[model samples]
Target: MLKALRCNSLERCFQRVTSLAEARQALAEPQTILWLDLFNPSQEELQDVGAAFHLHPLAVEDASHKHQRPKIEEYDSFYLLVFYTVQAEPSPERLRVCELSIFLGERYLITVHSEPIPELEETEQRWTRNVRQLEGGVIVLLYSLLDTIVDQYFPVLDAMVEQAEALEDRLFSGELRQRSFTQDLLALKKRFLTLRRIAGPERDVLNVLTNRDNPLFNEHALLYFRDVYDHIMRVADTVDLYRDQLSSTMDANLSIVSNDLNKTMRTLTAASIVLVVDALLAGIWGMNFEYMPELHWTYGYALALTVMAVISLLLLLIFRRLR
Candidate 1:
């Protein structure tokens, strides 16, 4: 389906079921400034649309596949933007990710995705309910979409921050090691790495502002793009910080466990030595039961007990000194 939303009016302004003929006609719009979305199209349909827009064959191929890394490609006439969306992880899972590809040109923007993401609907709703409240230009509208994606990055970061603090606390307090928590931290780090791969390419797409010759954003829109750039910067910084925190937390967890294990081993070593000495004494007495010298002594039992107690006390003191 092809849906066109006029930025100025902020309504589902003109949604046409675009056929090959209609798409060819759409290119002829004289003064329409609109956002067009095409979702879950078949391969033939993608090819038809691609042919209509003269898209890079490679870009169309990537769009048809299920797993294209998030990226941005600047073609002669428009920009091809590959981005991701998050869906609630089903049943027991925590989250699911989907990709979105956008073709942005001077007069209209085209979005393509395999799934109908709620974020797009939400974007549309915002455009519809609060149309006039928005800044009207294409870059501003683009910013809104980028802004939504970037903003979603925050909650992910925030959740990781909370997990980091929790892990830090557990490490300090010498609690049982949390292998799963470390795994979660690592998983989050990996996910953020994927995000980096996607967002990094976008820097090239949005880098238009720094160079005034680019047509994406005008002088008046540079600051808005700059603001979005700052947001992207913060997210990049946060990804790095969280990765560092995860590594540190894992190290701390390992250190705490090793310390606990070493302490346990030391105590067990002291006990083992003491047990050996006691066993030797008992064995000697037991074997020479035919009137052994120490066994025949009147106070032998008491003396043996006293000797064992002193040895135990001295061993404990030596261990304490070493510690």
Candidate 2:
């Protein structure tokens, strides 16, 4: 699906461009800036967008595929930027990553994504709310959009930390079994690693946008992008810190599981020893080929029963004290 919004400097308001022809018409206006968003575009739709905007074939191809790394590249007419949006999944996978490709031009901005991003809607809302104050350029819009995407990392990180802390608590609570405990830790660890992989490179993308000398960004826009850069840096740091925490959590869980297994083995060994004593006594008296003297005695049966009970009780006490 394709949606277009045009912001005109003279009108100081946002207008929706319903069709490609309308978008082209809006692009021709000197004081107007257009934002074209494509959600899961089909092959024909991509062709249309590429032809309409005169985008490079390589840029369109990159947008057509998924799993592009986060980076910025300069094309003939515009800049092709690949960025990742992440959310926490409820399944064992734990992390869901989506790629968003942005085409930034002087007069227009185009965004392509295979998955829906709430940040896009948030950026639109922010733009709508502050349309009158904005100077009707793509730079401010890009800043707002990038800032929203970077800010979203905070909540995702918070959720991951909360889950890690919960697992840590359960590790010592002695309530969780072995299998489920390990799976949860490993899943959480993977979540942190995913966040690190995306956020680290995204920080570099923002860094280039901020520090590089680009005529597209004015002083105000540079300030805005720098703010975004700062946010992504913090996100990168948080990801690294939590990744280390997850490693430690995994190690601690393994140690706890091993200790529990050893304790179980010790208990089983003690129980088996106690059972072996009774088996030994029964074996010696069960021979019937030659008559056993104790078996023929009057009180022999009671004496054997008494001896078994005494020995079992003594072994039980010893094992309990040792434990």
| CA RMSD of all predictions | 3.7, 2.7
Error of 2 at 231 (Å): 1.7
Instruction: Give the per-residue lDDT digits (tens) of candidate 1, residues 1-323.
Output: 66656543333254544355665565576544567677788888788778877788888887888777666667788777777765334432144677888777776667888777777876766555654534444565666677677667667656656756766776678556767766765666666666566556555555654454666666776776777777777767776787787777777777777988999999899889878877776677668466557667888888887887888788778878887
- Those runs of model 1 whose alpha carbons end farther than 4 Å from true positions after fitting are 6-20, 87-94, 126-140, 178-180, 208-212, 286-306, 317-323
Q: Model 1 residue 32 lDDT? A: 44
Q: List residue ranges in candidate 2 displaced over 4 A.
A: 88-96, 131-133, 291-295
Worst 10 residues of 1 by lDDT: 86-95
**Number of the top TM-score candidate:** 2
Error of 1 at 278 (Å): 1.7
lDDT string for model 2 (52-92, tens) is 89998888999998888899999777999999887767674
